[model samples]
Target chain A: MSDDKAGASPAAAYLAIDWGTTNRRVYVMAADGSVLATARDDRGIKSVEAGCWADELAGIRARFGDLPAIAAGMVGSTRGWREIPYVIAPAGVTELATGIGRIPEERFFIVPGVAYDTPDHADVMRGEEVQAVGACLSGLAPHDALFCQPGTHNKWIGLKDARITSVTTALTGELFALLRDHSILAEMMTGPVEDGPAFRAGIADAAGGDLLSRLFGVRASVLLGRRAREDGAAYTSGLLIGADVAAREVAGRLVHILSDPNLGPLYAVAIEAFGGTSTAIDGQAAFVAGIHHIWSMIDD
Target chain B: MSDDKAGASPAAAYLAIDWGTTNRRVYVMAADGSVLATARDDRGIKSVEAGCWADELAGIRARFGDLPAIAAGMVGSTRGWREIPYVIAPAGVTELATGIGRIPEERFFIVPGVAYDTPDHADVMRGEEVQAVGACLSGLAPHDALFCQPGTHNKWIGLKDARITSVTTALTGELFALLRDHSILAEMMTGPVEDGPAFRAGIADAAGGDLLSRLFGVRASVLLGRRAREDGAAYTSGLLIGADVAAREVAGRLVHILSDPNLGPLYAVAIEAFGGTSTAIDGQAAFVAGIHHIWSMIDD
Candidate 1:
């Protein structure tokens, strides 16, 4: 059904918002947690004027008639519409839902991200916590599992008994993009995102040695005419993902990869090359499912 | 002595040219290997128009007469004035000199870079091979040693029997520049290029884990208020260098770091932090000495 028609229905339930730095997605769900309609726009938290989050929520309410809304992602960041304190790990949906911060007068609340503190370092994640929660609730994740959410910041998370115990962020995708666009290696790469032999070769190359030294091979191989120029992108992708997987030492473990469509296959291939098995989950569906799960946990 | 005065001297020995991608330096040397005068400009190989190598050499000849000139670095690459095929390692000054490509009638020749081949990978170095030869001839490098020439591409060379046996290129410096100027971490950094505790901390952080994950800590630490934004550059440098050192497993060994003044101290510090000792050699002096050494080996 159309969003307006769903909004007009007496059965219209709750509004779920996945609000990140670059895009905003809203889902209309019935009381039973099934999505009825969805809407999205480029008005991410970064583009919204400061102190205007309330007004922005008001506009959304105007269309959906004041349905109670729950938001996730960077919308709760310092640079976002509001700054919500992080819920420390090992934390589950209950802790995350309980940490939600409400707008002063609106029927809107923001989901708090999860943070982990090790003896040597600390890490924090915003929207991915929602995805983790969704994965657990949707039964895609096991009681004890390793989850990899690959994107600009690829996160490898350790979950136990539905609680996120650890989080590690890899700058794989960002580094790949940076090198592809700016590094000397950029001159050699051809398009259509290479995937077969060149990519597997990259993964194999990443199996040993320090990544700092290995990265230069991308340029060196092409310059030496040892590898085809068209294979540059795949080689780079394999190198990054391979290094990441190797560092994690995920051998023999089943890794659940939650990634956008484009990156899912690459991570899966790399994981297998590194002696691990992985299953890919749709990121957007997991994101929406996560929001719905968290929204259901919040008390009126 | 002034360049013109030295050019007029009958005692003028030979010419040494260190031509890289961004800058070019020419040295007039006495027969005894002392530098009589030096000149430099931004007219590196990259700036020189195609087929203009002869014109460029002629302009220098007009100023310095018919003194035989030996050039090294990017000037011999495909993009340079002439393409000199790489001399395979285990190679030394004599081998490099023998591979020098001459310009038809001009008293000028280009030094060939050294290349290393492994069953799995290939690597090549141009100007630094000259410095490696210089380091050996100058007695700064041991018969068997690990040499690090730090710059855009940091080369870790294994020298034995006065020959470069192995070559590993680390893109540490280039990666640092990319992140410092373009990544999200750039917004948080204020620099005088940090060199103290933060740098050491970054090195320590790199001791374990993949670089892809460790790099993200630079941003997360700042956002979490654990580190000052100003320390970002040092932290990044430490992370890259530390990862490089740790990966090489160079503990307890003496590393000869041939670097420009600015990068020398930083590397020395990182090496010490990682349980190794290092000696910093001036890169430019080494370059000129390398050119002279190779030139002396060329037959009349």
Candidate 2:
């Protein structure tokens, strides 16, 4: 069921919409694998009401001209425009292409999400699967590699022979946001996070374990005049990212990170601090390449 | 500075207010260390404006016959009725009584909280110092023991020879509440948390480490149809508590828990599951005994 034979390539251009929960990125790709124009907006899948998906698609088509389209991410989840069932791991381009579902009476298709389930543990990802597979296709990473995709829910994906074998998602960004916006820790964190001494110190402390207790130290240290209040947010970021990296067997490994300009370096430093080497590959480029590869393989 | 000598006991009846951020517990105590009457209200220190503390005290005294009052918890902090400076640990009743700061032109006194500061770590507690000390005085725990006071911010205190030597606080309850009420995980958590198999399974997963990833698994497991939606909250509770317990040297140790009827047993099971023994001491009783002990030693 996962391995459908590749069909003949289409000669026309298509719209690749990476529709996420809060933001949508649209890429107008030519048949020759060049991006003609790209646009991003806050009109993510979550913004559209259930009966308004067609209107939303029509609006996108109104801007870019109606061409065939391939949408991914939350747009295909249960809460999105159409719910596409997840393709189980070990899955790759063929598995994903075969699992793609079509929108009724429209020339629109959705790339299915990926699920990693065992007898004891389970994990899933929607948009990130495209980026991971695309990273491999674009030669940014090897077919057998480890990729760290940092976001609200940071994913640690294990790829084997061009197929995604496992994924571990960490609630680092979301947890940080919650603590910064709503918890008592918010009052102490007035400054922006940077990869500096305070952050590195937090990474060092994370090596000792006990994250919950260490998290409170951010407030307690400031309250007791033992640490500067300005260093609070950075320390928190370090603690969270450090803990995420420390959980893995990264002591002697080369981790390929799907890089965000700001968050990528932090993870790289954290990984290096924890005795791992890393190379950051541009996340957007990988997603584009992934969607393009999938598009090339889709039946005309 | 923490070694003030005990003063002669006062003869008049007084008020013992265990005043925290969100709730206040008042005990009308007799001269002989017995509670005459008790009342609880949501008029915590946070509820009263800074300048209006005098009027708030007036309101309480107006109802309780203008008696002298000793308030603990946030009432002593900067945001409370008055900003009583923290007493450095290892501090006991004599130290707390000596460090007590009085409300200007009033018969009310606020017990100074304790601060455990070192070169690399710092921690402080307002009311829990009293509870931990009181637990020892009330014979619920030995002088040298480990005490876990669970709540929004759960404190892990190390007592040495009846004095608080160390403190480590975890944002377990607050984190749990934030996830349940705000995060994507909230939708999956419709049922109450219990100490059941689902929770134990979470504890087992926690033992494998990588907490941020394990936390995300709560949502993933449910989404993949591998776990029941009803068990989401319990699994989350277990993961958090288990991670907390695992962070400590709880193996073969007896942890003295200041019990909250609902949350106490969960910590107990987590401790025992992680190879530790535990005994639950009534938190309210400890507070009463602690305030009584401090009151008995205060100078008239």
Candidate 3:
């Protein structure tokens, strides 16, 4: 059951696994980098607190046949299979391959997450920083570019000369959830976003100045008749979303590495607010490229 | 039962009431404007709804002997005794005066609420608007200023030349409640407010950028090792209050405001974020001044 010889020969395949605290994903690629097949499991590091990384990888190999199963994420945490300390933000794919193996001397490269530990704060980027760096390469940009990956936790990473030098995280999506589901703003809001006037209005309200006083209008607008109660949820959602978009430096002459176009409007809002240049790229695609880039680095 | 004689005579005692949506307060005052006695009750309009205004007021009077009582809030709503039409914004104190009544030929005044009608929106202010306006006249400079009243519902009111010109509301207080009480943010914040690092961190996080993003940080910070989960409520509160304060004009030269100081450090936050002259006044003291100011404006 070895994927290395699943199709024909021993040198035909390589495995890439993105394993994290809560989930695991793996891709077996042919010599030319085409995905030969795939495997996924819920046996993330957090769930399988015991030594299940080997079992999980074995399961994937049983399905796709065994190959060099490289990995990333919490599999390398202090509590992970092997403690691979995160590479500093300025490190490149060069580090993702430097010390990667199921056990050293094997033909596998475990990607290193990026970490930033300053005097006042500490942050980590498990798998996406590499993807972001790879995305810049996908777009044929220079070694350096501005990378934006939006999700529950949105990261604005600065890549200088192909190295992720620094990054900032924004919790825009989570904020929307709290505001709509947790605040008095909830009373006014309903589900599923029927109208966008409140959303647009929130964006406009957040545009120029005064975050608090303008916030007063969210309630006042509804209570005082500026908006309807049902629109309240959307308005409140927009309030936080609009504020997040407003507070960030999304627009400036640079390539923005967004996850997808669904997050486009958010970045578009940032561009509109700051008068900056932005480009959207696929996060998953970047992940693939970053995997290959790491392989290239390792093989070189 | 009759303040008519007292109204006609210089020595007659008069009662002023700041009956609001959820709480009732009464002040027995001498003809010279000194408070002789004060009491409060839970029979505010919200407790009984609009149709029960008369019965509620009668109960309030029952607690403190039959006396001439001036009432405000829903008592003037369509649900209360009479539908006091809202006076236009920028209207005089005389304009906000509603349900002003007197015995046949006697003198007494029931303060009126104000209202504004605009092409896109309309607003109305009941009981507290009078007090806030009174605060504007009695305690503030004789010019235009914003009044910040924080509570279950926070109000940002504008005054022109010591008169209540217009008003807006922010549900910062209520938002704090909903977020703390119902939302998942509560699970992580299963304790009393530290009001120290947690609260300040919230303010800083919220103050850092778009509210939604900051809001998202509340959950992710906990999930991602950036912030403590127990601090979620305080941080959420700060994010909202910060958004509330940021909503209006906090910059430029003439943005002076009178705010209640008991709102923890939010006053300083307002001052720091909004920037201009601000005096953190006591809400309890202002309540007295509010009653006096409105009563003084009563036409005798």
In terms of TM-score, the best-performing candidate is 1
Candidate 2 local lDDT, A1-300, one digit each (tens): 111111112433888889999999887777877777777899987789989988888888777757889988999999998899999999999899999988747789999999999875689999899999999988989999999988899999999987899988999999999989988899877788989999998899888778988998898999888789999999999999999999987999999999888899999999999999999888888999898888888884
**How do the residues A1-300 of candidate 1 rate in per-residue lDDT, one tens digit apiece?**
345447656766878888988998788778887877778889898789987878888888777656888889998898987799999899988898889988846777899988877767678899998887688777877768788988888998888987889988888888988998889878765544656998888888888846777788877887788888888888788888888888888789899898768888888888888788999876767777777777778885
Better of 2 and 3 by lDDT: 2
DockQ of each: 0.77, 0.76, 0.30
- Top-down TM-score ranking: 1, 2, 3
Per-residue alpha-carbon lDDT of model 3 for A198-226, expressed as tens digits? 66766666665444445545555665566
Error of 2 at B161 (Å): 1.2
- lDDT (Cα atoms) of all candidates against the true structure: 0.82, 0.87, 0.61
- Compared with the true structure, model 2 gives a TM-score of 0.94
Give a tens-digit lDDT track for model 2, residues B36-85: 66778999977998689889888887666568899999998888877899
Q: Which residue segments of model 1 deviate by more than 4 Å?
A: A1-5, A62-65, B1-5
- The lDDT ranking, best first, is 2, 1, 3
lDDT of 2 at A281: 88
What TM-scores does chain A show, candidate by candidate in order? Answer: 0.94, 0.94, 0.80
What TM-score against the true fold does each predicted structure earn? 0.95, 0.94, 0.72
Docking quality of model 1: it rates as medium
